[model samples]
Target: KLVVNPEKIKSLKDVKGKKIATPQLGNTQDVAFLNWISEQGWKVDAESGKGDVSVVRTDNKITPDAYKSGSIDGAWVPEPTASKLVSEGAKVLLDEADLWPDKKFVITNVIVRQDFLKEHPEAVEAVLRASVRTNRWIEDNPEKAKAAANAQLKTDTGKALPSDVLDPAWQSIQVTDDPLAATLDTEADHAVEAGLLEKPDLTGIYDLTPLNKVLKAEGEPEVDDAGLGVE
Candidate 1:
């Protein structure tokens, strides 16, 4: 967990009692960290404070500052923010990219209502195509994306993000067009494990025939769930 002791400590042998904070417990970062800790034969002893690390929950802004000021160790956060902390002198303790490696570290996703997907599979395919095109556009024009993010932030939060946070934050977002992206499945699996999902019916969860049609017309193979390595 890069949010705490950001070093490549290699094992739970090192992270035993360091204080850590995340947006919330039972979130992906928290659950994944808990899973890792469990593998180490030591427990997350919140009460005893033995292997007892402090788990503080704080607002987003405080997370970076807390890590920087030494009030907290590290945090599970996305880039540009992770990059922001690093540029502001917080190092990359661990990257989710490193944990999963080229598999998406999904911060967000787009989900259409299943009934809609079923009713208008063509519309789903069109959207996925647009999404892919948008991704390519973003990658080619980072500044435009930044400006868009700034506009959104200003509209919603009424302020521009400081450049330190903005620049790296821009880098952290890896936009992809795969309508049936594997990372979606990965997140789905995570959801089931966390009990956020009662159970995921893979077939029910996807309507990839639309995506398949899109891919075929484009001269690409159909979207492959297995290739995404979600399972």
Candidate 2:
């Protein structure tokens, strides 16, 4: 999502010439923002993050502070970070999801080392089964899931998310079993077009058989690997 101080910007056009932060240089969010900027007929150096718009590579942990300090006008950030900025008086200017088809895109991925996967196929399938069930559980009981997530967060970070942040943040997420492989391929294309990445083969990058097996057992529809699955 793209969040800005309401006092400073009112519309997408106002984003021109503003210092916008992305989570990291050449990351998924950075590539998407760059692609959007290009679509606006604007120019920005992909590597240095300078031009008509300043793409500041700020860490999510410090982005709200950067905005509060007036160092950045807005941020194209992921969940909790976006919600946290909103709590500090930032208004959502645009949702990145709106730009994609059906407002769906991949935000996270689970990767397993090929060697480990080959040796521990059963373990891999077990993990996928657990993940599928957990996603469904989260969807079925959102409030309980939120509380449980906050509890885990507290254990890790020494504090739980405040309702102001947690509520909106939780609302923005979509827990899905699909890997959204096609969108990931599109993201790579966007990065290449923005000069942040080179075109490269992505064949055999996915192996969704184990996931599909779990989904089938759970009485769910199977997912495709966007033709990038291992042969």
For model 2, residues 1-231, the per-residue Cα lDDT tens digits are 999988888999999889999999988899999999999999999999999999999999999999999999999999899999999999999999999999998878888999988999999999999999999999999999999999999999999999999999999999999999999899999999999788968889999988999999999999999988999
**Cα deviation of 181, candidate 2, in Å:** 0.7
Full-model lDDT for every candidate: 0.61, 0.94
Q: What is the lDDT of residue 114 in candidate 1?
A: 69
Model 1: per-residue Cα lDDT over 74-183, one tens digit each? 66665545665666555655566666756455556567896787698778778977766676678888899789878898899788888877876677667754544566
The regions of model 2 sitting more than 4 angstroms off are none
Listed in order, each prediction's TM-score against the native is 0.72, 0.98
Candidate 2, residue 168: CA error in Å?
0.4
Task: At residue 185, give the lDDT of candidate 2.
Answer: 94
